[model samples]
Target: MSPELSFSGLSVLVARVAPHTVATVHALLRDGARVTVASSLDDLPTSLRDLAERGLVTLDPRADPTAHDVVLRGDPSTSPAPQPQPRVAPGSPDVGTVTLLGGGLGDPGLLTVAGIEAIRVADVIVHDRLAPLSALRHARDDVQVVDVGKIPRGDFTPQERINEILVEHALAGRNVLRLKGGDNFVFGRGGEEAEACTAHGIPVVVIPGLSSSIAAPALAGIPVTHRTLVQGFTVVSGHVPPGDPRSTLDWGAIARSRTTIVVLMGVATLGAIAETLVAEGLPATTPAAVVADAGLPSMRTARAALGEIDATARREGLGAPAVVVIGEVAALDVLR
Candidate 1:
């Protein structure tokens, strides 16, 4: 007979093994396995009864038997061992290192105090296209600024090469600031760069800034979530893999979900995304909005139905660094 078990935070499966199955389970438990028997009080195996008598396992009668044959619940008190800290080399110059700082969503005023401070203290600033040039005015005149903008399908410094530059400048006793457009950790590949620094025994610090993902939409007067419109929201990366066989996203779930959908770096694949949503049962008339160059003086916004997004974006010339908002909340903007 199958038995189901439930405990604080564990799950276990058991089938008709043998009469001594309970003893085997008990041995496994003593060796640090948390087990629970979910069958009725009268249906427990003899081995389970023995373990229960010894207080090693608990028996609960309220579990479903058909769905789960046997259920073992683990103890929640135990946790894994802590990891050791990385060792730093002796006499390494701590003065020269890299700080990956986030430049907030194209607005110099949006920059945090710490971000401005980093700019003032940096000896060299390695920046991207998204970072506003006005923000750099705070830096010293002698501070070297290197533009490493990665244009799509254009001349660009590879990520590995960028990491090498940061390290080389730091080892040369120069305080380097790796200025990024938005939050470094959010789809910015900052983690990979941080790992590279760690592997080379170079110290790195991260300063997070406002990501354009939400700020861009907000600057365009579009709230990602509204209590009357959307109860929750989901942010996704629109950069799907080339020739990706497996579905990169579950469009059906997103379409059916009553939550706001925000897509970052999705302008190029806008048509495909709209089609996927429509095909997955989202209405073609669903409200959607796109904000381009958000938080900048040249910021432009376009609102349309799901079916009209692709054509509208093309006609309006809305391109990269744009934020896409999809859901009922987008429709409310018309009233505002």
Candidate 2:
């Protein structure tokens, strides 16, 4: 909804049906533009199919994108391979730069001003599933927005392929933005991406975000620490169960730490985590809480003692991309 902007006479071609792509198509249609979505029928979700059925959009995989007034590269895999570029001489002006931006807790409002500026100036944006796609409204109509988000236990873009996409776009003289949810370095694999960019001689910048580890619980009115109850906090990954060989966490030390405990990406294994912590000497009656879909209108919170928190969350139908808090603070809703 920009002032004095209209697409009444334009036809737009969107190359794929990604989450961000769908948002863009809707925006164009709202502006009175005719839109054609190009992708296989199998990739068309019910919403897109509804649009096609109503004759509001033309859905064709073989549509000639050149026929449209505007063509969007919605998915990197669907974009043409970047052609070779003339190498820049040493110490010469760098052609393109990459900005690593964190989206923060699934809310566009949580996205920092610097992050939005980066998006507005980017020629290509490579984003993750948890990142705020709504913020892409700030991007140019022609900016190539690629969805490389990884869904837990589901289809995802390989990290290797994502790295290649960043490098390819930078080498092609396009300013690239690698956007994700939460702080880039907090279990975000941002270090690896930064390293890749440095190795390839691409100038890279990182703008930190509010990590959901702290934000989610706060939004749910549960503080991770309180001066009288806990002096510090420990953030852990619950993606792997306690007994899994892949897990290097010392559940014993964590349980004995006697500090606020915040677990991220641990919803699926909360039962095992609680059991291990209690067996390792933590009190079974310790207060625990789960905040799901943080920073969203549908966000829900579930709370129980350490011994029953997992079942409580399950009974409440709460799921992942959640923050699990265990400590005295979980029993207090300071905001309430």
Candidate 3:
């Protein structure tokens, strides 16, 4: 294919290749980049041998293990051949499909293999504020990104509007991906989206994401459940206060159960929830931890007794998009 955009000054080197990544390389060739294809960067052409030393480019030049699945794009003297793509099935017209992908906890690298595939093929992506940003960089340049992120008390997008966007795009024969933070069904309102798609006769596909309730704590070195200590665990949404009539959680049962308690979206009501648990028989000395930005560089964790967790959270200024663990496991800091 002829070059559409010129990467005239750019130099690209691809190493340890995979068959699927070849298409991206072909794209680079079409863009007019001076690309060098080698099994390893160590064996670069004599002219570009010092490329690594010049420090012109490096996503992470430190030490990329000689083996990885990333496909890099570049160009050469001749146009690169396009890789073969799957054929469209006969009689099955290409209809609009909505894929709900889990963006993982905070770290972009945590996105699942299937989630990456969905992003690469999507025509439009409607993402949440907490969605893994690193995963979005792999999307094709032409892909449309729609921000429908809902912050706690800040800018918010109504759910109906999000559903409308998905349905409207699918009706137009475009593949839309609703990328969300954590598992789509784990308080993600994914079921409602599926229902909307089904009501409108649109095909909906859901891809599970890593929920913060479990992954966040683990990233902060506190497992929600332990082999010998915790036989089971319970995850609850803490958006409502214990005394609120609108709340449906059974605090009494939760306090009586032996399972670990993992709360999502409960930062605001932590104090009331903790007090209720203690009133309902949950010990005040139970171990607890509040972990924010679980897998990111700024990740912070504050651990204390259940009676003190609310204060610890206040002192640390920990905010939402965090995982709260209360039980014997939160006391353990094995990950450090």
Candidate 4:
């Protein structure tokens, strides 16, 4: 009683397994297009595998991308498939390069030209949750976007697993782009990735992005440094409270430094951070500010004296993925 599947002349090659990609493949299959996926059967969702068992999809890593009418990307925004590139068989002997790219804050507009170029040529993009999603829009239709975003204290792809995926894709002759938010070298664990690739003889490159530690504060109209306000600044991670064993920073030294202090990933422990600074000789009345969701449309900033900043940010409902700035300059609205 069902209508016959159509797509007599259309062929689709699926380069990755993602919610959008899988859904697209399902539609393509239902419409009778020949669908070939470049992933192992074990990697597919149950729904996709059911379709495969019904002779609707083919799993082939060596699938020739050009043979298909279109190559599929996971993002729905990339529909209509990009112009086909010179067909090359996946898993070819050609060694692919890996580019570690910084996605800047949350704004795609902040992505550097070099970073965009890298995305354009990448065969696979291994990205974090914070990376600018716009880069995915510019990727080739056949590009495989692997979401490895890490959520603070939530479900996330393990670093070891991410490292394995990069090496695996590159070894299969596919250019891999490792994209993360902020400058990759700035607590982004880029060094570990570079080391992983080079250990396997894969060539690696870096495209730096504007770090939120600096960009976020600036966008919120707070300068990290001012000649008359402070002589220098220190950037620290607030992932842990000051006295937690996991933290290696010396709060006393930071408090006594007499310079601007910029804290990243510190919103959860902002109160503790403020307390430690005050307990260590920093003035309780020092000006401070919290810039949340920088570069995005919903960005918000809350300012208060150092002792009250944590309470102020909470009262304002600011959350993680924010930057905290402490110094005399925090009170100055230079842009205003």
The per-prediction tally of clashing pairs is: 1, 0, 0, 1
| Candidate 3 per-residue C-alpha lDDT over 150-264 given as tens digits, one digit per residue, 9 for 90 to 100 | 7676556799999999887777677899998898999999999999988877888988998888898888777777898998899999999898999999999999899999999
lDDT of each: 0.70, 0.82, 0.73, 0.80
Candidate of highest lDDT: 2
Model 1 regions more than 4 Å off: 1-91, 241-247, 334-336
lDDT by residue for model 1 (1-336), tens: 111322223344443333324423533442344555655445754334434544545566564445443443432213332222243352376537789898877667788899999999987888776765456656665566666667555446789898987776676667789988888998888898888776766778899989887788777778888877778988877777323575477777887887888888888888888888888888899999888877655578898999999799989988876888888877665325
**Global Cα lDDT for candidate 1:** 0.70
Please provide TM-scores, in order, for all candidate models, with all chains considered together: 0.69, 0.78, 0.73, 0.75
Candidate 2 residue 101 Cα shift, in angstroms, is 0.5
Reference-based TM-score, model 2? 0.78
Error of 1 at 265 (Å): 1.0
Question: For candidate 4, lDDT tens digit of each residue in 277-335?
Answer: 99999999999999987885557899999999999999998886799999998998888
Could you tell me the TM-score of candidate 1? 0.69
Write the number of the candidate with greater lDDT, choosing between 1 and 3: 3
Runs of candidate 4 with Cα error greater than 4 angstroms are 1-93
Which candidate, 1 or 4, would have the higher TM-score against the true structure? 4
